[model samples]
Target: MEIVIINSSPRKNGNTAQLCDAFIKGAMQTLPKPKVTTVFLNDLKFKGCQSCFACKLKDSKRYGKCSLNDELSPILSAVNKADCLVLASPIYLMDVNSSAKAFLERLCFSLGSYEVGYRSLAPKEVIVVTIYTMNTTIEYSPVGAMDNVDAFLGHIFSTPRRLCAYNTYQFQDYSKYVVDVFDETEKLKYRDKEFPKDLLRAYDLGRDIATRL
Candidate 1:
C-alpha cells in the first residue's frame, strides 16, 4: 500500500510535522508495512491551477489530469496512485496555508468533472485524511475552515477522516518574540500537559487507518 502525506507547514520540524511523524511511526508498526512518502509543500516550487481547461477538454489525452508541468506535477501523479492521501497543514489565519489550498485546487479541479452530476474523473478511489494544527484553542479555532475542501474531496473520492491539534506551541522561546497576546507560561503548560495526548491520538488514528486499509 502507498500512503502519501502532503505537509504544508513552512517549518519542517514544527508541531504539524511532529504529529505526522507520530502517525508514520504508528503506521510502521503494523504488519505488511505500507510504503509511506512525505512531501513538503513549502519546499516545492509550484502555484495554483491555471484555468487552462485542458483536463476538461472532451476526448483529450490530458482529460482528468493536470497539464501544468512543475514540481507539484509528479506529486499529484503519485497521489493519484496512492492508496491513502494525507493533507497535513498548520492553520494560518483560521484556514489552511496557501500551499495546501493551491495543491487542493490543482488536484481536485482536474479530477472533478463538469458533468451533469459533477462526477469525479479520478483514475481510482483514494482514501483522504486531513490533519490540521493550529495555535487557537478548539473553541476559538475555525471549525468550518476545512468544510469546503472536505466537501470537494468527498465528491471526488470519499469523505475524509479529519484530525486536529489545537493550541499548538508556536515558538520555542515565546519571550524572544514580541507577541504578547498569549501567556507563554500557559502555552507551555498546555504543551506539556496536552501535546502528548494529541500525538497519541494521531498515532492511534494512523494505526486504525492502516488496519482498515
Candidate 2:
C-alpha cells in the first residue's frame, strides 16, 4: 500500500517535521515495503481557495479540482492516489499554520464538492499530527488544536480512521513568565530530554494506522 505525508512546517527539521519523520519511520518498520511519500508545503507555491465554485460547474470535467495551475496539482494528485494520508503541522496561535490552513482550504474547496461522486478518490485513512510549544499541563491546549483537525478530517474523509497529536511544552521562551521556573535554554533542554518520548508516541500512532490499513 501507499501512504502520503504532507508536512506543513515552515521551519525545516523543526519539531513538527521531526514528529512526522518518526511516524514515517514506524510505519516503514511495520509494513517493511509500503511506498511512502513525504511532501513539504514550504517548497510548493499554491494559493488558498478562492471560492469560485468553478470546480463544481456542471460542464467542468475537473470539478472538485483546483483550476489554478500550480505546484499543488501534483501534490493533490498524489493525495488522490495514496491509500492513507498524514497531515503534520506546527500549531500557530492555537491553530494550523498558515501554509497548512491554505492547503486545507484548497483541498476542501476542490474535493468537498465532488466527494460523493468521487468517493474512491479520497484517502481511506487520515492521521493528523500537531506540535506546539505550550505547557502540556493545560488540559485544553493540545486538544483544542487537534479537535479542529479532526473536524476538518471528518468533512473530507468518508472513513477517517485516526488522529494523533503531539505537544512539547516548555520548549522555548519559558522565562517570560514571572512564576515560571524554567528559562528559555532550560526549556530547550527539556525538549531535548523529552524528544524520544514524543517520538515514541508518534511512532505508535503510525504503526496503528498501518495495521488498520
Candidate 3:
C-alpha cells in the first residue's frame, strides 16, 4: 500500500515531528511494509491558489491543475497516487501552520473541477495528525482544531480519520508570551511521559487504515 505523509511543521525536530516519527515507526513494524513518502512543507516552495479559474479551462493541458507551478505539482501527483494521506501539523495560532494552509488551498484547487464537487480527483483514505500545546480540557484547545481539518478532509476524501495530541503546555508560567525560552529537559520529560500514548494511538489508526487498504 502507498501512504503519503505531509509534515507541515516548520521546526524540524520539534515535538510534532517527533510524534510523527514514532507513529511512522509503528507503521513500519506491520507486515507487507507499506510504501511511505513524507513531504515536509517547510522545505517546499509553493503558493496558495489565486482563484484564477485557469484550471477550469477546457483544451488546456493544465486543466484540473494549479497554474502557478512550483514544487506542489510532484507532491500533489504523489498524493493522488497514494492509497492514504496523512496530514501532520503543529498547531499555530489555534490552527494549522501557514505552510499547511497554503498547501491545502493549492491542493484543493488542483484536485477540484468546476463541474463537480470538491472531491479528490482520486478517492483515498485520509488521516490527520495535530500536535499542540494547549490544554485539552479548554474549549478552544487542540481538539477544537479538528473542526478545520474535518472540513478540509470531508471535502476531499470518502473516508477520513484523525489523531490529536494536546496538553503540551508544560511551561509553568504562561504569564508572558515569550515562546523563545523553553526548557529542553522539561520538554523531554514530558515527551517521555506523555507522547508515547498519543503515538500509540496514531499507530493504531495507521494500522486500521492499512488493514482496510
Candidate 4:
C-alpha cells in the first residue's frame, strides 16, 4: 500500500506528529515495505489558491493540477499516486492551520468547482484518515471542529476516518512558563494517561485502514 501523510504541525515531535508516526508504525506492519511518505506543511513554501482559474479555464491541460510552480506540486503528485491519504494537524483556534487549509483548497478546488460541487482528481478509491490534536477535550471542542469536514472530504475521496487527541501537552516544561489557567498536574494526567490511548488507537487505525485497502 502507498500512504502519504501531510503533517501540518510546526512542532516536529509534537502530539500530532507522534500520532502520525505511530500510525505509520502500525500501517507498515500490515503491508511489508509499504511506500510511505510524510510531508511537513510548514517546511513547504506555498500559498492558498489564487483563484486564477487556470484549472477551470477551457483548453487548459492543467485542469487537475495547480499552476503554481512551488513546493506543493510534488506533494500533490504523491497524492496522485497514493492509495491512502492521511492528514495530521494540530487544531488551531478550532480549525486546521493555514497551511493545511490552503493545501486542501488547492487539492480539491483546482480539481473541481464548488458550483460543480467538491471533487478530487485523486483516485476514486483512495482512503482518507484525518488526525486532529487539540488542547481542549472533545466535549469542549467547538461543534464545527470536525463536523461537515468529514463529509466534504468524503466527497473528494472516501468518508475519512478521524482520530482526535484532546487535552494535549502544550509545552516542554510547564514550570518554565507562568500560564496560570492550566493545572500542570491535571495536564500531566491527560498527557501521560489519556494521550497514550490516542496513540494506541492511531496505531490500530493505521492497520485497519491498510487492511481495508
Candidate 5:
C-alpha cells in the first residue's frame, strides 16, 4: 500500500511524532511490505495558498496543480497517488498548525475548484485520516471542535479515521520554561499512564489501514 504520512509538528520528536511513529510501525508490520512515506512539513520550504486564480483559468491544464514550484509539489503528488493518507498535526490555538492548514488549502485548490464545482481527486477507496495531538484535555471545547476540520478532509479523502491525544507533553524540559497554566506533574503522570494506550490505538488504526490495502 502507498501510505503517506504528513506530519506537521515542528518538533522532531514531539508527542505528535511519537504517535505517528507507532502508527507507522504497525503499518510496516503488514503484508507485502508496506511502503510508508513520511513528510515532515516543518522541513519543507513552502508558502501558504496564494489565492491565485491560475488553477481556475479557463482551458488551463494546471487547474489541479498549485502554481508554486517548491518543496510541497512532490508531497501533493504523493497525496494524489496514496492508497492511504494520514494528516497528523499538533493543535495550535483551536485548529491544526499553520503548516498543516496551508497544505490542506493547497490540496483543496489543486484537487478541485468552485469553477468546476467541488470534486474529489483522491482514489475512490482511499483510506484517509486526521490525527491531532493537543496540550489541552479531550474535553476542551476547542479540542472537541477539532473534528470539524475533517469536514473537508473527509470529503476529499473518503470517510476518514482519527486518532486524538489529549494533554500532550509540551516541553522536553518543563523546568526550563516559564509555564504555569498546566500542572506538569499531572500531565506527566497522564502520559506515563495513558499515552501508551493512545499509541496502541494509533497502532491499531495503522494496522487496519494497511490490512485494507
Candidate 6:
C-alpha cells in the first residue's frame, strides 16, 4: 500500500511537519507496513493549474490527469495512486497556506470531470486526512474556512478526516521576533501542554486509519 503525505508549510521542522512525522511513525508500526512518501511543497517549483482544460478533453491522452510538467507533476501522479493521502499545512491568513492552496487547485481540478453531474475522474477513492496548525485559537478561527477545499477533496476522493493544532507556538525565542500580539509565556505554556496531545492524536488517527484499511 502507498501512503502519500504533502507538507505545505515552508518550515520543514515546524509544527505541521512534526504532526506529519507523528502520523508516519504510527502508520509505520502497523502490520504489513505501507510505503510512505513525504513531499514538501516549499521545496518544489510549481504553480496552480493553468486552466488549460486538457484534463477535460474527452479524447486527450492526459484526460483525468494534470498536464502540467513541473516538480509537482510526479507528486500529483503519486497522490492519484495512493491508498491514503495526508495534507498538512499551517494556516495562513485564516486558511491553508499558499502552497497547499496551489497544490489542491491542480490536484482537484484535474481529477474533477466536467460531466453533467460534475463527477470525479479519480482513479480510485483514496482515504484523505488534513492537518492544520495555526496561531489562532479555535473559537476565533473563521467558520467554514476550509469547507470549499474539503468539498473538492471529498468529491474527488473521500471526505477528509481533520486534525488541528490551534494557538501554536510560532517562534522558538519570541524575543527575536518583533511581534507583540501574543504573550510568549502563554504560547510556551500552551505548546508545552497541548501540542503533545495533538501529536498523540495525529498518531492515533494514522494508526487507526491504516489498520482499518
Per-candidate TM-score against the hidden true structure: 0.97, 0.78, 0.79, 0.94, 0.93, 0.97
Query: For candidate 3, lDDT tens digit of each residue in 1-213?
Result: 777888897766765676667667766767358888988898998887788877778898878777787898788888767777777877777788788888878777666656655446544454443334333334557555667666666666643566667656444454455655655566556667877787777777666666666
Global Cα lDDT for candidate 5: 0.82
Candidate 1, 9-116: lDDT as tens digits? 999999999999988887777735689999999999998999999999999999999999999999999999998888999999988999999999999999999999
lDDT at 95, model 4 = 87
Of 2 and 6, the candidate ranking higher by lDDT? 6
Query: Please, what are the lDDT tens digits per residue for candidate 4 over residues 72-127?
Result: 98898788678999988888888887888888888877655544445455555679
Top TM-score prediction, candidate number: 1
Alpha-carbon runs more than 4 Å astray in model 3: 116-120, 123-138, 142-145, 169-192
Judged by whole-model lDDT over C-alpha atoms, candidate 1 comes out at 0.91
In Å, residue 57's CA in model 4 sits off its true spot by 1.2
lDDT of each: 0.91, 0.68, 0.68, 0.84, 0.82, 0.90
Provide the clashing-pair count of each candidate structure.
0, 0, 0, 0, 0, 0
Every model's Cα RMSD, please?
Answer: 1.0, 4.0, 4.1, 1.6, 1.8, 1.1
- Find the candidate with the highest lDDT and give its number: 1
Expressed as tens digits, the lDDT of each residue in 46-119 for candidate 2 is: 88777778777886777767777789878877776677777777766777778888888777667665555544
Better of 1 and 2 by TM-score: 1
Span of ten consecutive residues with least summed lDDT in model 5? 115-124
Better of 1 and 5 by lDDT: 1
- Measured with C-alpha atoms, the lDDT of residue 81 in candidate 1 is 93
